[model samples]
Target chain A: MDAKITARQVYKRYPSVDGGEITALEDFSLDVADGEFVCIVGPSGCGKSTFLRILAGLDTASAGSVTITPGADPRKPLNNVVFQEYAIFPWKTVLDNVAFGLEMRGVGKAEREATAREWIERVGLTKFAGYYPHQISGGMKQRVSIARALANDPEVLLMDEPLGALDAQTRKVLQQEFMRIWEETRKTVVYITHSIDEAVLLGDRVILMTAHPGRTKAVFAVDIPRPRSVESTALPAFSDLTYRIWQELEGEVVRAMGEEGQIKIEE
Target chain B: MTRNTLLIALTLIAWNLLFFIAGWWQPLWWLGLGVGFALFIWLADEAGKTAPLRYQRTYEVGLAVAFPVLLLLAWELIARNEILNPRWFPPPTRIAAALWDLTIHYDTFNKTSMFGRPWLFPQTLAAEGWPAAWSLFTESHVLTTLWRVFAGFIIGVIPGIFVGMIMGMNRTVRTMLDGVMSAIYVLPKIAIFPIMMLVFANPFGEGPKIAVVAISAFFLVAINTMAGVRDIDPVYIQAGRNYGANRLQLFRHVILPGALPVIFAGLRLALGTALIVIVAIEFVRARKGVGFVTFYYWEVLVTEKMYAGLFVVMALGVLLTFSLQWLERRIMPWR
Candidate 1:
């Protein structure tokens, strides 16, 4: 029950055109416990990515503060991220891209290469070790991104819609792989995604957020056990959880549609 | 025949109208030339329809070259027959003869005196005075101009990238340098040559030439580097920074690599500017280089030798352009 990352009363707002400010997250607060996987789901543009950025220290909350608990050890702290676009460097090979974090940490060349090679083999990309980011498909690229983030062995892994661009078949495969990896590593993970099935399959807890000054509407603890499969969506508990989250999410989606109309009218 | 006949009829009708209105045979000659050109074009078109495209293309090319030669021969024959003035519109054969005399018998145009003094202006092809190749060996004025150009290009490009990169990296640096760079960029560089020479002095005798070349090259490189840096994707910096990169590390890892293609762009522009300034400098006053050769030949109205020097300058420009392009390809193999 020990919280790994604590965010208390986090509020973030961005300025819009014509001097009006758009509130992204308002009075948002969440706690991620050690070795737990949580999924944050919201309508498009509900500031899930913004909240993640604040946690990553890329952006500061406008009103509140976010702190990592007892702090990260100077040797290895908690947070690493796998971005939605698979932000792998195009110029680097799959192996070098994965090794970049290790390289930054002053890891020896031989050791870093060995670690990278091990991860590449784990991700089923041993054959593509020398291939550049652009040469691979989106699914393969995401695997490389996963390999890179995990290579750092961070305590808390923040994934921002990491499987958002993949085909349905590939997404299902990666979700299973993600569960396997999580079971193996037992790392605290905060994943941002829109897919209800994804939220159910991968996350131990699902945080459904409302739009227009995005705030958490409800939190659901998934009753599903370990090694959950994509086929579990057919089960009563899976559909019930998805239906439950959608009830809170549908109103925000409509509100977002209304906002889009207003924005078009204003334009 | 249907299309050719129709075109011929239209052309003849147009010519008759002109002849009637102007009361001149000039329109008839124009009609004749048009007919001659049209006939060849029609024949080629018809021939293309019967033959394979490649063979037709080859025949068309032959016709293109042959038609021009035939026109020149006809004009020469007509002029020689006193159909045209020999004084102003000399026969092509006579011009060819004149060219042969100018190229072969050297004394016709330029004849050197018993002393080493340049007496007559040498014709273009005449191997008189010093062979053009001699400039490549000695400390000729042409060599001086080229040296100044290269020196200026190097001096200008080196600091240009350094300053540009610094400004590009930081917003404050960009704000401070942008205005100064803009002002220098707009100013007429040629007009400031006198001032630069006055301030610096031809201390090395070749100092002003080299200074002018360097000055011209610097702004181009700097501005380009600044632009390159400014246009770099912020994602690269953010990516490096997120990975615990320091400022120097970010520069080495992300900034320089991302800005390289753009820096190469600046170098190419600076090189062109360097060449222009060096030539202009030599035109004013210089001890060596092709620019001096051009100026020296032009002063005595040795038009052909001036052209020869100009050809060398053109060759140099081509050489530099290809060399830089090769270097860019070598460095940025991915591009």
Candidate 2:
């Protein structure tokens, strides 16, 4: 299987308040194949978002190099990102927000709007086309953000906890919609989240990460069939994967929580 | 039928009794005339109300019309009767008459120094006759004053915004200039007028009045603009960068838009400053301008002319403010 993204060892260091350094990530490596959906889940501040941001070329890795295999035209969309904070432009209408990427790519107004309307409707935001970001709910804003990323038709879509801000019910509904959208678009996606259930539901493979000098602890193949529903989560296979990943993550999480001689892990 | 009607009747009786006792009118006839006038006013207010509410409509309408009318009458009685000296407070009727004559002679008055000098000031016969618009137009002093205000505002605001934006964006620039600017901003810009006069004294000096107006207005605009630019949010700048926006694009899209509300605020302050400085500058030894006309009237004791000059200044100020408010609404429709 051809890998879409290959990362050798990566190390990232950031400055602390005391003029010393804090290591965010160390000796991190992962491989993702074309058409694959990968989800990364860990405890809080595990540098998952940092990994995704680096993949999106928003930040540079201190040591390792990340490379993407050439596939689609580079001029089209190479990598698109949806930030965690519902990063829709407040000044733009929902339609304009969705159409932003196409507009940036120099698409004509008519063509951009035409294409944007399709995705806007797909995200169930056609009714909100004329509304500004502040007028919409958090879920709807995230939908507009997702539509914006999709409008670019990128080869790789990096999502940094795009659904983390929504209410639980809305999150579930949007997750279901996201699967349908993924099936329709078939874009390679790398999703970062702190939720174990979200990782199991969305990813073909789930990469478990440790905190404080974050590193990939293990990669588990979901091996679950596609066209999956939230109901699929009730199955034994889903529970087994969740339990196994949790089992592996528990040790690293303990180590991560420990300082000096004390090692305490919260349930 | 309503409490308002009763109240109005009572008010009319009271006013009529005052008029009768003061010997301005006969009690019976004036009382009847007052009642009729009150009824007419009440009807005008209640006609639009579906229920014909008595007290509410009459009270609202009565306040609106009667307050100003009463104030004017008091002013006229006080000023014309010398209760308040005409030099200090001209009668409203006399002001109205002067305004009418000014309107009639506006053309000639603008071109000629119709109100400027005692000899140039028209005699009773000429003053009574309507003058040509050419005189008003020929009065270049108003033009000169206006030109100075416009020039000062432009010279002050352009550099102010440019510098303010620079200091606002760069921490180093901000730190370097913030203290200096604070000191300069508070220093009375008008105090420099004497110095300017000494420097530009009588060699093509064109009088230091214009320079004085320019300087005072400049510091006001500059201080406000710096505050405007410095107050822009960093998130806006970061957002622009995330979208692949260059420095220029960041300024054009985010910084400019963010700074606009504050800049308009500065402009408003600067406009007022320009007006004040222009008047103050022209107060000292200037030969022309509304300020000069006002001082000239006061010196020769033409109290009516001075009041007229003041009225003109007030009218110009109101008109300018209204226009700027309209433009502000048009540009920032979202706001």
Candidate 3:
């Protein structure tokens, strides 16, 4: 598999209010292959979102470089993001929000509308295409967000805990929907999440990171069979893999919580 | 009868007896009237409390209508009986009659009419072309006020939004202008009318009046637009940029829409301020506006006509508000 995204020793630092520098990411490197679905799971403030933002070209690394190797089509956007908040414009209808990326790229109105309608239909939101963001449920809004990212036909998708805001049942349903969509498109995606189960279920490879100046802890290859579903999570192999990843992440999570004063460690 | 109804009936009888039969037109009689009214209101409140949920809305509407009708009746009675100085505080009927007179009476000396006799618009159009028909509107005080508001509102809001956007996007610009803008925002716009008059070449022309109105609107809109732009969620801007939107596209797709709701709020405020500033300006100088007519009527002790002018001002406010709401709905369909 050819590598489509490469981040070499990325570092991010922010000036604290007290005049000292706080590191967000330190010596962070990631390589995502073509047609790969990679999930980066970490504790809160682990800088996984920061890394995704850097890849999306929304922010720059303080040190080092992150690059996306352009595909054959120059017209296609390099990457599109699925924000955690769903970030859909309240002033736009569902169809318009879905078509926003194409519109921004100067696509003709007719072509963009057609494409947006097609995606809306795919998301089963055809009936709601004319509805504003405020008129929709959170799960439905997130679907629109996903459809928007896909409709742009970008080379890569960067998702920042897209399903994190949803209830458990909605999250599971969307995870299945997302898996099905990824199976169809095979677009390279870098998904960030705190949910270990989500990382195990969605990604071809799950990368775990340590907190406080986030760095890679472990990378686990999910050798599970293709065309996985929610039923796969009931299987012994799936549970064992999830358990192993959790075992690797548990110490990092506890340490992070302790540092944040959310938890106390005994000796 | 129910206890509440009985109490209300007794209160009404007591109110009339205290005024007519007792011939007690002193401070004590007035106190008795107040107590009687309070008792009636208490009975009404009790009735409202006991009303069924489905009938609650009917009760509210009844209260709304009854209070205003009762107040108008009291005013008519008080003015007719000379309880208050009728010359200064004319009854609602007199104000309505005065308004009717203003509508029909065309002043030959001033060459102006209240509505330019809009009833004659069809006849004017038939006798003359569009220009002649347009003259009917131009020769009215109402039209003058409307023109100033519309012109000043447009002139102020457009550049106000532009400069506000600049202030919102650039941190340094925002820092530089924040203090100055804040200081000016709270200053009463009417206080600067004298300066505006001095600045214009014609002190008594439309220039100073419109400038005062425009300046009032500009500050309100600029401040509101700045807050609106700054208040937009940063994630939307990030999404726009992430999707390969350049500066203009980001503004069109993200910033403008995000700021629209707040901008509309500002527009509404600016509109109200514009009306106030124009009226104040007219009061101070202009010879051909609703405010001018109102002040003129007050000067001549024509209380009814003065009240009519107040009525016109209120009507203008309602009309302008409705027009703005219509425009806002058209522009922001998603809202």
Instruction: Please write out the lDDT profile of model 3 over residues B1-335, one tens digit for every residue.
Output: 37777778787777777667676544354565567668768877877887889999999999988987777776776777677888999998999999999989988887778888888899899999799899889879999999999998888889899989999899999999999999999999899988987998998888888887888888899988999999999999988888778998889878998999999999999998899888888888877889988998999999999999998999899898999999999999888
iRMSD (Å) of candidate 2?
3.2
What overall lDDT, based on C-alpha atoms, would model 1 receive against the true structure?
Answer: 0.76
Q: Rank the candidates by DockQ, best first.
A: 3, 1, 2
lDDT of 1 by residue, B1-335 (tens): 35765665566567556655775434355555566567656655665565676687687787788887878776675565564655545666665554333333333122311112223335422664455433223433344556677877887778878888888877998898789889988776777878777877454376666776777778877887888888877755665666666777678767786788888888888888788777877777664567766676679765555655565677688889999999997776445
Worst lDDT 10-window in candidate 2 chain A: A258-267
Residue A154 of model 2, lDDT score: 78
Q: Is candidate 1 or candidate 2 better by TM-score?
A: 1
Q: Write the per-residue lDDT of candidate 2 for residues B216-299, one digit (tens) a residue.
A: 666666666667777766544443454445667667656776777787887788778888788776666666676777777788
How many pairs of residues in model 2 come into backbone collision? 15
Best by lDDT: 3
For every candidate, give the share of true A-B contacts it also has: 0.13, 0.00, 0.87
Report the Cα lDDT for residue B49, model 1: 65
Alpha carbon lDDT of residue B314, candidate 2? 74
lDDT of 3 by residue, A1-267 (tens): 789999999999999777988888999998999999999999898999999988988889999999999999989988999999999888889999999999988899999999999999988899999999889999999999999999999999999999999999999999999998899999999999989889988899999998988999999999888799998888898899999998988999888888888533421
Models sorted by lDDT, best on top: 3, 1, 2
lDDT of candidate model 2 versus the reference: 0.75
TM-score, first chain, each model? 0.96, 0.94, 0.97
DockQ comparisons of all candidates to the true complex: 0.29, 0.18, 0.70
